[model samples]
Target: MNILHHAVLVKSVNITSVAKLLLDNLLRHVREHVASIGSLSTMTVATLLDPRFKTLGFLSRNKVQEAVRRLKSECTALIASSEASLPHPSDAGESTNNSSELWCLLDETVDQKRQSFNATADAILEVEQYLVEVNLRRHQDPLEYWHKQKHVYPYLYHMSQRFLCSPASSVPCKSVFSKAGRSSANEETAYNHKQ
Candidate 1:
């Protein structure tokens, strides 16, 4: 949609005044409706995650930054959630010494915090690298690209599956239903004639 909006939205076009006015009105209405539906975070994230169309559909770098920030936030949340859901190991047999055990707990606390901080940093770097890489070929499938990259970016692969797997709008589904209904009706008419 964003691509289409920018495609013909240039003053360099040589159309007549009346034609240009009609185009301006059409662009205005399309922009208004797209803006209304553009608040969806999923759409933003999906566009960013798509290897073929990453950030190209966005109007500005700030918008790209916003999407990247949102992706990182969700990535962090997913990391934290997975850690919380994991089974905890049973406590070891009673410690032989109290002094070491007291300090070990403190060490574990520090280690865990450091690990969490590092995890977030690593995730941010991953997002940056993904964005920096050139877009995949238009003929390539985003999901397939992600699948091949799963080992390199497991978190993003999981996320891309969640976001990119579904159709963005209902239009495709509606068209499919309409076509199916017409085909079924035609088949019924043919069957009636045969009988």
Candidate 2:
């Protein structure tokens, strides 16, 4: 976001023709690729959940709220869908021919758990708790962190499995700067040849 903002607003007449051309192309490409942060909600939410870069990459408070809302929406949906798939208390007896004491106890436990379940409140609390915690070290592995936190935030653990496994894009942003370095080196080599 900073790079895009700087690229668009930057203007200087003293720069070489090559630099001016590069800056123009960067702005054009940024516009072509990223219309707005809204388009990357999945990436944004994933970053918000990341222990290391939770709020670092965001540009504004509004964007942070937007991403958090998106995550909450998805979290509730996931919890609802999973709950819907579970065998109901009454259905449990029908599935098993044995009317043993163990099955009866299990059904009672399931019923009690179901009665206490509050998906919305739990989701909000878990998300808030996650945000309140200190960020993990920069070098720490987020997957490892999430793995250890699986029991602490069960729904988020499942959601992270869905979001964090794959990257937002095949081409990461760091590679763009690497490509620019090569282009600058080429320009330097050509300039030396001209002399």
lDDT at residue 98 of model 1 (Cα atoms): 88
Best of the candidates, lDDT? 1
The alpha-carbon deviation from the true structure for residue 99 of candidate 1, after best TM-score superposition, in angstroms, is 7.1
Q: Native-vs-model 1 lDDT?
A: 0.74
Per-residue lDDT of candidate 2, residues 1-195 (tens digit): 544455456655578889889778875664444446334767777777778767655656777788888888788777767767787646443554566667777877876566346666677888888888998886888899999999999999888888875443323354455666787799999999999
Candidate 1 lDDT trough over 10 residues, lowest sum: 167-176
Candidate 2 Cα errors over 4 Å, as ranges = 1-38, 90-117, 168-195
**Per-prediction TM-score, please?**
0.72, 0.60
Candidate 1 similarity to native, TM-score: 0.72
**Cα lDDT tens digits for candidate 1, 121-187:** 8779878888889998777888789989998888888899899854443333344446656866998
Could you tell me the C-alpha RMSD of candidate 2 in Å? 7.8
